[model samples]
Target chain A: MLNIENLHVSVGDKPILKGINLQVKPGEIHAIMGPNGSGKSTLSHVLSGKSGYTVTQGQVTYEGKDLTEMAPEIRAREGVFLAFQYPVEIPGVSNIYLLKAALNSIRKHQGLSEVDAMDFLTLIKEKVRLLEMDEKFLYRAVNEGFSGGEKKRNEILQMAVLEPKLCILDETDSGLDIDALKVVAEGVNSIRSPERSFVMITHYQRLLDYIKPDFVHVLAHGQIVKSGGPELALELEEKGYSWVENKQAA
Target chain B: MTTQTASRYTAEYSKIETTLPGGSLPWLRALRSDALKQFSGCGFPSLREEEWRYTNVSGIEKNLFEPRLEPSDNQIDKDWLENYRLADCWQIVLVDGYYSAEFSVLAGLPENVTIKSLKESLEAGDGQIEPYLGKAVGIDEHSFVAFNTAWFTDGAYIRIPAKTVLDKPVQLLHVVTDPNRLAATRNLVIAESMAQAQVIETYVGVDQAYLSAAVTEVFVEPNADLTMIKLQCESEKAYHFGGTYVKQARDARFNHHNFAFGSLLARSDIHSDLSHGSECHLNGLYLGVKRQHLDNHTRINHLEPYGISRELYKGVLDGRARGVFQGRVVVAEDAQKTDSEMNNRNLLLSNDAEADTKPQLEIYADDVKCAHGVTVGQLDEKSVFYLQSRCVDEETARNMLTFAFANEMVTKITQKSLHDLVLAEVLKRFPQQGIMQDWL
Candidate 1:
């Protein structure tokens, strides 16, 4: 479902993701763990088409299409979703309004009829209930004044709404408590299907206990030094990325 | 040759002054003469002037404008007027600076509510109009205010009797339909002791090239309450200059919401005098797009003890547009418990767009609460990504988020029809393909 070939990215002139290559098939969950400043977030940003990042060399393909040239919105319409580490607080837009616009945009791209207000409300209400999110959240501005757990849950709620083909959860578990972590993971797990793929980026293996990954890739200094099964996450959580760095240097 | 040009310029003003309307009341005649003198001395405020630094009023000098001599038979289209007409209220219509008796509807006015034109009020032995007509604003300081004071033909006159509560809102509609002509109108509103009222004023223009200058004076008597909402949506090529001067009596409450969305060159001046124990709230939002320029200047005076004031002005500029906000709040001596806060926020969507916000506070009282804040920047990248990541395109995401920023002020409008009208105009000026359509 997703492929990255020799992707070298930089912020300004400083290379962040250097010679990175990875691949994931449908229904597969991949976990990328790295130390701080080890290009973990940079990989996610570059994959999601964020500006201010220079792709010096390499290409990214999603579902057999070149993803490097697509704008962020086009990538989004093409079923690429990024759950931000810090959800943005949009002061004046309600969450329901944002969600409806997102759903309609994707629906239009897919040659489907846009959802009406009533149908949209019904759709979101079901998802909100499924996520155990408060219905009042739909009325308030998107993520404005929301607690940390609420923001992460809101991110997951958006993932559920958009139902993207490829989901990238970037540091989604950083600020969450144990309860929120489980709920968020549960939300992610419920959406796992054979036709969908997910890339979960985390520092600890706590979130892996809920949504286990099929592949674990250890990223250090902008390259994947090791790749293994879900147990690699627990091993790294125990030994840390320093051992991976030493192994890569060797 | 140089002396010849200087004499020619002086001769032009002399020629123009003679053509102005004359033979009014002595006091009014004297006031107009003095104002004309001041106007001649100042000419047009150049960009070199500190207050006019960002605003270029050379357009006014480019075209020679004559005060509207007579009301035109060219009536406003009923459909267009109907779109702006507020129902279930006492309505007053002023067309081309003259009260339109044919279009006005006044029914079921409470016994204490007084609504009339300035002419009728003056002729009907009402001496109250003369005392507060031009007391709040200095005509000598502002060229447009001076011009409005000099040439105003007639305007709406409203007076709420002491201790009276006006259950219904009073709607004032000012319409201009002539492109080549200029109209200056003046309004005076007074709410006596313990009286309460809501005033909604709508300024409409039909011709794109016409000019409209207006001044409104409001005096809130002791313990009275007043909420005034001004909606300025003129033609795209029209020029609009307006001034609103408010004076709150002891323990009175005065609130103003100024919404400006359309015009080629528009500037609004809002000044409030918060006297002893008075409370004032001023909120404004200016939406400018394309080549439009919208400027708002607000001044609040906290005079006497225990006066409070709060102000928030937001601007959204796109497509090489320019927005200016100059706010000043003054706390006078003996105003010990005075509390004042002012904030201005601007969103520039394009690289060519610009915004200038200057918040000024002067406090003479040692014990006071005064705070001012200003923020100018582009839309948040994280927020934009958050929306786009949801499958909303970049343009639509931007529009929605920008609209939300300005909607905070639009939703504060209490009247539904007026609110919808202003909201529609505001949305029309938003950047295309941004979040405007869905929320609007």
Candidate 2:
């Protein structure tokens, strides 16, 4: 479903993602683990088509189409979703309104009529129940005055609503408590299907316990030095990235 | 036309002063003369003046318009009047600057709510009208104000009796229909002690190349509550100058909201006074596009102890338009326990668009809480990208973001229909700034 071939990326002349090559088939769950400044977040941003990133070399293909040249919204409508590391606080904009606009935009792009208010309410109620999120959160401004756990849960709720073909979770479990993390992980687990792919990025191995990955890649110094199964995450959690660092230094 | 310019203004001032109707008292005549003298002494403010630094009124001076002597009765369509009516309120329409009794409905007013024309109020010998007429906003402080005072022919007068609560809002529609015409209109509102009322004064025009000068005075007595909404949506070639002066007595509450979305060149002055234990909230939003210029100058005077005031004004400028905001809060001596906060935020959408914001606070009271902030920048790129990542196209994202910024003030409006109307007008004026070109 997704392919990255020798993708070299830079931020203001400093290389961040150096020759990253990865492939993920449908229904596959992939995890990218790296230490601090391992270009984990940068990879997610570039995949989401964020501006200000210089793609020096290589190409990215999504579903056999050129993904690097699409605008952020076009990529989003094409079923590519990125859960931001830090959710933005948009004051005075209601969460429900934003969700409705986003859903309608994607629907319109797919040659479907926009959903009415009643239908939208009915649709969101089911998602809210599945995610165990309170309906009251929809009335308030998006991410404004939200607690850390609420923000993370809100991102999961958005993912459930969007139902993207390829979902990239960036540090989704960073600020969540045990209960919140489990709920978020369950939310992700429920959306797992054969036709959809998941790319989870994290610095810790705890989130992997809830939704096990099929493939785990170690990223160090802007390059993926090792690829293994779920046991690699446990190995890094037990030992640390110091071994990877020393190997890169050697 | 240099020195003779003074005589020209003086002649225009004297010509209107002598023609005031017979119901006007001698004191009003003296006040008018004094205001005219002050105006003549100061003449027109130049761009060199610090207060007028960003605004250039050279065009206003070059094309001096003569004030209309009598109201015109041409092509006043009934559909247009109906279109201007606010939902579930008494609609008082003013045609070509004079109150139109035929189109106004005052029969369903509450028992204690008194609505009348200014001319009728003056002729009825209502002693309550004189003291608060020009007391809040002095004409001597501004040249256009003086010009309005010296020439205003007719205006709306509203008075809510003591302890009365008006359920329905009162709508005052000022419509200018004559092309290349100039009219000076005024509105006087008095909310008695413990009374509550909401008033919406809208200035609109159909004719291009016209000028409308308006001044509204509001008095909130002790324990009274007043909410005033001022909307200016004039012609594209029109020029507008409006002033709103408010006074809050002891323990009174006053809220003023101004929305400016039209006019080629528009300036609004809002002066609010909070007495002992009084409170005031002044919020404004202006959208300027396509060479439009909008300026807002607001001042809050905190007098006596335990007074409070809060102000927030935002502007969105695009297509070489300019926006200026100058907000000042003064806490006087003995006004201890005063709390005041003011903030001005602007969004510049185009390269040539400019925004000037100055939030100033002067405190003489020792015990007070006062702070002011100003920010001028483009839309947040991260926020834009965040919205876009949610499947909203760039145009929709930008429009939603800008609307959200202005909705901070629009949500404060209690009237739903009026709020929707103003929102539609704002959307039409801004047009999503081409962010939706691909989708369209």
Best by lDDT: 2
Please name the candidate that would achieve the greatest TM-score relative to the true structure. Answer: 2
Compared with the true structure, all predictions reach lDDT values of 0.84, 0.85
Given candidate 2, what's the lDDT at residue A77?
Answer: 91
Error of 2 at B175 (Å): 1.3
Individual DockQ of the candidates?
Answer: 0.67, 0.59
The estimated TM-scores of all candidates read 0.93, 0.96
Q: What's the count of clashing pairs in each model shown?
A: 3, 1
Candidate 2 versus truth, CA RMSD in Å, comes to: 2.4
Ten consecutive residues with minimal summed lDDT in candidate 2 chain A? A92-101
For residues A1-250, write the lDDT of model 1, one tens digit per residue. 8999999998988998989999999999999999999999998888888888999999899988999889888899999999999888999888887788788889999999988889888879988988899999988988999999999999999999889989999999999999989899989999999999999999888899999999999999999989999989888988877889998788
Candidate 1 residue-wise lDDT at B111: 66
Query: Residue by residue across B103-161, what tens digits does model 1's lDDT show?
Result: 88886677668887885665565767668877877777677777777677778999999
List where candidate 1 sits over 4 angstroms from the true fold: B1-30, B33-37, B44-48, B431-435
- Native contacts matched by each model: 0.83, 0.74
